[model samples]
Target: MTKIEKKNLAWGYLFIAPAIIGLTLFIVAPMIFSFIISFTDWDMITSFKWIGLTNYQTIFTDDIDFWNSIKVTFIFAIVQVPCVQIFSFLLANLLNSKVKGVSIFRTLFYIPSILPFVAVAILWMFIYNPDFGLLNQFLGFFHIPPQDWLVSNKLVIPSLVIMAMWMGGGAMIISLAGLQGVPNYLYEAVEMDGGGRIHKFWYVTVPMMSPIIFFNAVMNLIGVMQAFNEAYIMTQGGPDKHTYFYLYMIYQAAFKEGHMGYASALAWILFVILVIVTLLVFRFSRNLIYYEAEVK
Candidate 1:
């Protein structure tokens, strides 16, 4: 290579060195260390003890709570992903329309997404409180009975899902942007075919918006699957472990119980599950995601 070429290459590496170093230090190296730690039995307070596959064996055979966390994680993902995505998409669509005061409503809908997650969870906790809470008070005005929003097993998961909906404000903004970009001629073509609003939505809007939908769905799925803060701050694994998400269990082991090794194993297991689930979604989404470049 010429001297100039070598100089350019060196400069390029110099510019990107910080990013490479940061990734190795903060992400890649820690992942490798955690994997190694998973094979041992060491609470942070004690010396390391090699346990081989014992942690995995115990989890598979004896740890009832592990299975419960797995169940709760998947259940939360399944319920939250679609409901939040669809609701946000519809809300965004409404906001995108020529409704009066839409700009105000759009700002209101997205304001929660920027708030601190802990603060949002605390706010929802107040809303869900049975006595002197805003929710029960509003229900009382309508003569509806006060319902246990978070304390009951049946209500806890749903209450968390409702709280998660606040985080979907970002998704609503994305959907709004996608809705605005949709070509007017496409809707006109649907109208010419005597299609109603449902037909236009199903044929024109959804197809045009599929890429945005797919992106939001994957994001929501991953976020819900690895849920922690809502369960931690509000339920703390709940009245009956109904909100005992997988990540929360890992946190409980590592921090609360000081079982760092066991927690690493649990974290790796969740990592594997999330990877497989995400890959499966990508695999099956071949026909679902529509890009405008395809037409070009």
Candidate 2:
């Protein structure tokens, strides 16, 4: 209200103006458009016609593929999220140790995460090829029969989960940084209290890293829920739609089926699902996450 206070507020707004503009133009505007589209019946070729709740009704009742996509998405998120999080956490912990060439090893591990999705998909396609692929060749040495990975309905999603974990190097790096931020004094103190490795990890490392772990879990969950590129490039949602994730199904509705309204509705559903899941995660984290100062 005072002149000095007004001047400070003006300066703060000026500093954040670019970010505000970018968010309005890119994120907020598109979300509004998408919500509007969800209520209409429009192909790109035709004018949008308002058809309230039709898209939503069809997805819940008439669209079998929509249900299938939801099921697949749920399964993928459930399996991949925890597996990748645990693996990345363990890897970060291992890499946090005082080892020789840790930087080189870290770089090598992280290269996959930086690779373009198209390149990674193609590379994995070869690796998962049924005949004469690296995986089959490796199995041959032990006299195990060659298996169809991407083409098998039972195996395709799991294979994708494995590929996702392999390239989850970015999350691992974040967890490593979190691990390093844990005070060494806490570990030493635990040891003096007659704690062993597991005790120290349970009391010190886990509590200290709780916030980062929660962050990584939420991020990975959101990413897996929107999985499309791998399903598109590798399986094409084939093997009887076993890998038909939600986003890929949305793409099909929009582009292949010429059902833009339906696609928009699906996108809205996915957005809602993500928001609910994230909120649930935050609710659950109240019991799990332990700030260092609060613990004392």
Q: lDDT for each of the candidates?
A: 0.90, 0.91
Cα lDDT over the full model 2 = 0.91
Please write out the lDDT profile of model 2 over residues 1-296, one tens digit for every residue. 99999999999999999999999999999999989999999998989899999999999999999889989989989999999999999999999989899999899888999999999999988998898789989999999999999988889878998999999899999999998888889999998999999998888888889889899999999998999997788889988998899999999999999999899999999999999989998997788888766843
Off by over 4 Å in 2: 1-8
Error of 1 at 56 (Å): 1.2
Clashes of each: 0, 0
CA displacement after TM-score superposition, residue 2 of candidate 1 (Å) = 3.4
Summing lDDT over every window of 10 consecutive residues in candidate 2, give the lowest-scoring window. 287-296
Candidate 1 Cα outliers beyond 4 Å, as residue runs:
none
Alpha-carbon deviation at 176 in model 1, angstroms: 1.4
Clashes of 2: 0
Per-residue lDDT of candidate 1, residues 59-178 (tens digit): 789999999999988988888888899889999988988978989999999999999988898899899999878999999989999989999988887887887786789999999999
